[model samples]
Target chain A: MTEHTLAEHTLTATDLRLAYDRREVVHGLSVAVPPGKMTMIVGPNACGKSTLLRGLARLLAPVGGTVELDGRDISTIPGREVATVLGILPQSPAAPEGITVADLVGRGRYPHQGWFRRWTAQDDAAVNEALTATDTIELAARPVAELSGGQRQRVWIAMALAQRTDLLLLDEPTTYLDVAHQVEVLDLLVDLNVTSGTTIVVVLHDLNLACRYADHLIAMRDGAILAEGAPADVVTTDVIERVFGMRSRIIPDPLSGTPMVVPESRHRMENSA
Target chain B: MTAHAVVAGVRRRARLTTLVLAVLAAALLLLALSVGTAVVSLPDVLSTLAGQGSRATDYIVLERRLPRAMTALLVGAAFGLSGAVLQSLLGNPLASPDVIGISAGAGASAVTAIVVFGAAGPPVALAALLGALLTAALMYVLAWRDGVTGYRLVLVGIGLAAILLSVTSYFMTRSQVTSAQDALVWLTGSLNESGLDELVPLAIALTILVPATAISARALDLLAFGDDTASGLGVEVRRTRLALLVCAVALAGTATAAAGPIAFVALLSAPIGRRLARDGGPALLPSALTGAVIVAAADFAAQHAPGLPQVPVGVLTGAIGAPYLLFLLARMNRGGHGG
Candidate 1:
């Protein structure tokens, strides 16, 4: 796989407001995702992590302010042009029934194709490259519906990678996955970022996983950023207590040297105390 | 593989196999054109086609049988293309033009036009189009909440189709016996005869609409991946869907108006086309051709099926289409949430 040199495609929000059905979900939120880095947005459930991710990807329009893509206003950019530079995977990635891994990955070329161009040699090359990168080339012809959760997750990521964009945004990609599958997907993503310098902005629920996988962390509460910095700099017990409303002790991971939080659950420790 | 060696390879063998099948379909179409109710012999049919036959044979070949064959071919093509688009758009096997109430709505409206308004003109096509559009609109409204999901659309279409069919039954019972008999052939679908007057308008509509639909084929393929992903990939989600839905309804409406509601062409053709292509994307032209082949063959079978009272061509399609639907539903049930 030929890794395209990732030019920093900075995504910034200026005083963003987002809502659904006239009810505000995010209010005057502003943040910038530092380009050429893996950034994780972490928060409690319903705290607008997914919504913010959606707004960043331009899948949802901000009710107020502008989302800037690489210094240009995202709303002004043609959707196809925007897609050529930015790709997104929602929480649930739907697969067409009976579609094989290779064919599903090939659909990521939709943004790159014109009406007259059928799949060419280059398209097939990209599909094969994505499959190999995701370690799914052996399962190229297997129907997506028959794959394991971890395998399916890789297939979805491979599809995103097939877009060959500088930036990728994922919304809760590990929601239904087991712990092992979650780690496997996160590891693959890390490899992708390291090898290609692809800017990744992801929403994650597990704080420890977020700290381990992310180079930069954005902690959110009620649609606003609580703190943003390197995992070691931002993922302190005090910050966790404030953002997640849970008392926790912080320690470094033995292997990765990333901040690891050991939550102090009141119910579990009450009898001992 | 060398040039001559590759010619003997599996890929070459597959192509050769399909080429033979395509030739067989062509031959069957020719035989069907010849052996209608009048039983014109193959030699006479061949001579007539070659334009060196008696005036009676020439009249039968060019004027009488040719139009009927053309109607079957065109109507079948429309159904196949429309059904394939609908199935892929709705992302379910059960969602075909006929099963999803588009055809039923057209049939019901055409029946009403004939029975109530005493509409004695070719304007029945207009009524059919109106009925199809209205039915599709109602199905969308009923299915829509946040957005129209595949499961919801099919379920609501089934209910809507049942209601329309009942209304049609009521109208048939109230109409005069002779008009009712004519309505029966129209409802069950027939190609007994069609003048150029009826065939020309349908041909024109198909010509304008089918190509327009092909232009949206890639967009529809993206759509089958589901709404959010399609939109993120730069497909104009609402506009693409509306355009495809309009094309499907128009195709189904036009075919129904031209040939009364023909059976299973829409339902059977798309899956067959998908199988033929052996890929996930909707194969519009191949599906349309399969549809034409199916309807023409079914019409042929209607003439030949012995011991049965002369049934409408649609009866054969229903006999095939209904079981396929059941099989899809059973398979879905068995698979549960795995899909």
Candidate 2:
């Protein structure tokens, strides 16, 4: 295995205005990603949570404002150079048909290669390490199409891990996963964050899981931030009601003592129950 | 540890398959050079190639058979590589250059240049190249809706193909019968008139385009994960795509200019190559080799088959490819690939 040094990167979006065709999705949103910490963004569906993540990662161009990485405009940086510092895994990325897990994961080395550069020993080491880290080493020889859903998701995560970027962004990485698999994936991210001090950002649908895993939490609604702070400070009953538009109670998780939200629904009233 | 070994194994298998296909193509090429009404043997063909044959043998092998075989081989390779590139880029098995109207565009312009302009040689070739590039540009424009997906491009190409074929038929009907006879043979993709006029320009184009494609194809792999993931991996998505599409269009156009759009060579090569090499990635080199073998064998049959009328090489390939297309369509309808 190769030695991996802890990495530092500061990514900030300043008044970002992102759009798809004619409709602006994320409007004038400003946020700074806390370096070396795990940040989670949560909100209701179609509220531009994913769009903001896309803007921060430079996957979608901001129509109105600039995003900066290490205090420089990200658009000015060469794509491969930016890729070496920051890796992003979009939700539901498809693997090529008949591609082996190893080959699919090995493609993450694209950023490190040039037109003249062939595969090297370091690339192999990185791929091996990624497979081992994701516990997918045994499945490396198998066709990706043949893998179970949870295993395929792990392989995608392994591919992202192989990028070895300091700033890693994932957009709803836990979709299509069961409750157990979701926790497993989140735990894996925590391990990466703790071990390498990688600045990690995640867009999550599960608000409670977001609160449990995040060192910094952000709640958004209608393309604007409702609250941003530590999970305990940000995931309040009022904040949840405002962001999610549902009456909710905030309670401490029994296992981790993290803020947990219990949303009140039609059947939760005393007479209905 | 196991991953490295596994990848190395797969690479070895691909290399072996490519070598085997190359040898097969070479063997078929020699057979094409050797046999005809002349009844020359392998040694005679090899000796003729080495400039040691008797005058008659030399005339038969070098002056006549050699040019046609070389055209068929190179044209096949051009169509094959073009198909492999476009299919990988679009992420659809049926997204070959011929199926997507690039070949039709080239043929339509070549036919027009022949019938309308009374042109021959280089002028028609230029018109075909321009037509292919313009059609590709038009397709990209029409398919653009925020962005062009593979599905949209494929549909738009099919629509354009219909229009281009009509333009070809109209020109054929309005022309003199003698010119129509000439145009008809070229439109059906015969190599009877193939010579240095076609071969030199094509060879030069391949020398440049093939290497460019090999370099850009690295990005094509990342694109299999979709545009956002590919961009996140540091590919300049739009630029890379445009470069590849340019290569695909130019290759198809050049080959069509040379041999008048040989039916189904572009549509057939990549899938056959992929299955032969068992590669997950687009087997471009292998496809080129497979295409060379297909056309060389088909042309040899056209030239030397006893008791059979000599048909154009395109007829044999069209017969094979049309059925395979129907099979593919049926399979797609019954599977998740309907879209």
| TM per prediction | 0.90, 0.96
**Which tens-of-lDDT digit does each residue in A1-273 have in candidate 1?**
443657557899999988887788888899988888999999999888898988888888888988999899998888788888899998888887777777788788888888743656666677777887888887876788999988898899888988888899998889889998899889888888888888999999888999999989999999888999999999888899889898888889998999999888757676444
| Candidate 2 segments exceeding 4 Å error | A1-5, A271-273, B47-58, B336-339
Q: For model 2, what is the C-alpha lDDT against the true structure? A: 0.87
Q: In model 1, how many backbone clashes occur?
A: 0
Q: How well is each residue in B261-328 modelled by candidate 2, as lDDT tens digits?
A: 78888878998988877657788889888888888877777777887588878877888888988887
DockQ, candidate 1, comes to 0.35
Global lDDT for candidate 1?
Answer: 0.83
Q: Score the docking of each candidate (DockQ).
A: 0.35, 0.70
Report chain B TM per candidate: 0.87, 0.95
* i-RMS, each model, one decimal: 5.9, 1.5
Poorest stretch of ten by lDDT in candidate 2 chain B: B299-308
Cα lDDT for residue A179, model 1?
Answer: 96
